[model samples]
Target: MPTYKQFPLADTAEGLTEADILSWHVKPGDTVAVNQIVVEIETAKAAVELPIPWAGVVTELHVEPGQTVEVGTPILTIDVDPDGAAAPAPAATPAPASSAPAEEEEMKPLVGYGSKAVVTQRRARKGAAPAPAPAAAVAAPPAPAPAPAAPRGGYVPLAKPPVRKLAKDLGVDLHALTGTADGGVITREDVERAANGTPVAAPTVDSGTRERRVPIKGVRKMTAAAMVQSAYTAPHVTEFLTIDVTPMMEFREKLKKSREFAGIKVTPLTFAAKAVCLAAKRTPDINAVWDEEAQEIVYKDYVHLGIAAATPRGLIVPKIRDADSMSLKELAESLTQLTETARAGKTTPADMANGTFTISNIGVFGIDTGTPIINPGESAILALGSIRDTPWVVDGELRVRKVMQLSLSFDHRVIDGQQGSEFLADVGALLADPAMAMTY
Candidate 1:
């Protein structure tokens, strides 16, 4: 009378169709508890861990590692009543009607874990009748409610399995801190904060291998498709400008020592972000979207600034919402947190959605400048070049100054050359002289 339950792959986020199985934590005959992580999956947006809903012994693994499975497909099986009378009834035998109610009540799958449609039982295979329920059924006792403070190394916290793994890797005890997420769930940020900024190491490749082939999926595949669609649909035009940023660099050093800016990271990108916001106000076309279906040009009053970050997974752009309204100190802090979360692979899909403008800092890699592609749904993107000591004329005398290159690429259908030039010039002016922001 052992009751077997198959767990289907769930949709972790909106519009998630399929996922690549990255790894599995449990196997056949292994005992597992409710809410324990059973597998890790990589969707189009981010990596997520799926937790089991039933406390049972694992019976079978439907899929293996590196397999791509669609949502609602059975991935794992568990025997919830392992100590029942005996094995399950065969598919040919029909169980007594009296046992159906107890079996249905005790063996319901956890809600909101699979496809949009609730699956009450396993789908029957082609030309085959469905499996039969056991002749006798026993209802398992309900799991005890979670305690406020779980014992060290024993309590399963109110966090996702991946978050728990992250906490373990960072040497953080989840029991010590309170959850800030909705319904008192512990988030990755809480674990990171408790760990005091402990860095996660990137995966390393074998140095002996001459060549390697990696499957194109996840964020990289999505990025590729978007870039191709953008390049072919949008008419692209790039413009470049070189400017002296000696004044801006000097101002940055001064802000670092000031009481107001203490403990805040003030990088060149922070200044560039502020300049983009200011310049977008002067030339709104740069912060516009070309609506093809609606046949209208959509201009945004608020700015969702996107910073292009290169991480181990791939290139991702996480946005700072309503950045134009924030102060310089606030922008700096947001930029720091955004980049850190992105690099740590903790940025959610919502963080990268609905970006109005994007800025790519090529200078961090010591590159001068290159024409950056316009992000989809965005009209323009700016690239900041390296700051080099170059000889320039200032008030007649030639002197070495901190010089940088600026590149702006825009969709020509939305932004004309004049507007693009004005936006680029405005940003350059602000960076050339930080005091010019007062005029904007």
Candidate 2:
């Protein structure tokens, strides 16, 4: 007899209740080994690949890709007794008057993880008749409308779990909407079009397409929630300063050419990050968080500096741990790795958590400056503006120099104007003279 086993969705992390199945590596009837990576799932924080615990032949896939399943739900089933010989087929015989009750077996859960017992009941023998439906239920009135025809191959339309949920909430049928995404994968925009009574085959670039509806989830969703919470809860005070950063730019170019920093792409942001880290020590309050419930100021001894990175998913801030202790080269290398990891969507939850300070380099986007909202649990965020050639007075002589604007947004509850201005000025002074950081 073949032993059927179920694979439940394990709790990958604390507070994570569900995950969206991004893709499956194996299908039914495929042989798999123990600890083999079987599927990839995307939680709110990161994408994780799950492994099978026992070697076996895959029997069934209970959940489909792009579906969000809760912890303890069975994702796949396997047959552990694949090596066992098949039993001989039974001969046709006269049916007995009655049969014994089916036996149920409880599946063992994965080690260190607990899940609800998945009971598998034996199927009735082929000759056994199904129990009759209740006569009163059979006589019930028909539904007002005829049931919609099931799609071919029991096809549930391909869509991300969020899109499916959106379609459900908007009273739109996903099966009826044609997907614009690759491989006929339905998107949030498709569901929105259906909800708005727009044609499913309508071109996205058409002038009459009007508005686009984007589903807020993943990093974008988390960022929005955090921004809203920070904006309403913390009294934000923004201060702007325009300074000549010609020296910082020159320092970066010199470092790029030096053999000590050869092959490393040094940018002005590197100097800005170093300046912020050094200046934060002078104004420790800027690196602290306001504890509303405790009514106390929580100051951190170390800085897990968050560098805001914009990815295809959305804006994500992956922090560099212990940035204050790192040398200029170390900081540069860490920043490079952090940014690459963030853009690749491989940034883990631990990388993003426990940020004491943040730097949003908007100069990369060529925008001058804007008031940046504080990251939740952090007191201040520095915004680096575009660097451009501007006329400036140098020793009573008008000269064209590379000037940049810096905007600092701080929580008024934690940092007053005097301390905030001083902190911003310290950072500016360091950029104006790179050697100023050595003194700190």
Index of the highest-lDDT prediction: 1
Q: lDDT for each of the candidates?
A: 0.81, 0.80
Candidate 1 lDDT, tens digit per residue, 1-440? 45667677787655878888889999888999999999988778776778898888987776657666777666787777788765544556655655552224333445555334323332233475644454443332212112235356764456654576588789898777676664446778888877886444334557897875666778889889889999999999999999999999999999989999999999899999999999999999999999999999999999999999998878888899999999999999999999889887788877888999999999999999998998899999999999999999999999999999999999999999999999999999999999999999
Lowest summed lDDT across 10 adjacent residues in model 2 is found at 139-148
Q: lDDT for model 1, please.
A: 0.81
Task: Summarize candidate 2's per-residue lDDT along 1-440 as a digit string, tens digits.
Answer: 56566677887654677877879999978999988999988767667678888888987786677676777666787777677665622334432334322223455665544454444333233575643333333432111122246666787887765676688789998768778976567888889888988886744465776666654555666788889999999999999999999988888888888999998867788888889889999999999999999999999989999999988767888899999999889888998998889888888777888899999999999999999999999999999999999999999999999999999999999999999999999999999999887788
Any residue pairs clashing in model 2, and if so which? Answer: none
Q: Residue 344 CA error for candidate 1 (Å)? A: 1.5
The TM-score measured for candidate 2 stands at 0.76
What are the models' TM-scores? 0.74, 0.76
Which candidate wins on TM-score?
2
- What CA RMSD would you report for each candidate? 14.9, 8.0
Enumerate residue pairs that collide in model 1. Answer: 1-86
The alpha-carbon deviation from the true structure for residue 264 of candidate 2, after best TM-score superposition, in angstroms, is 1.9
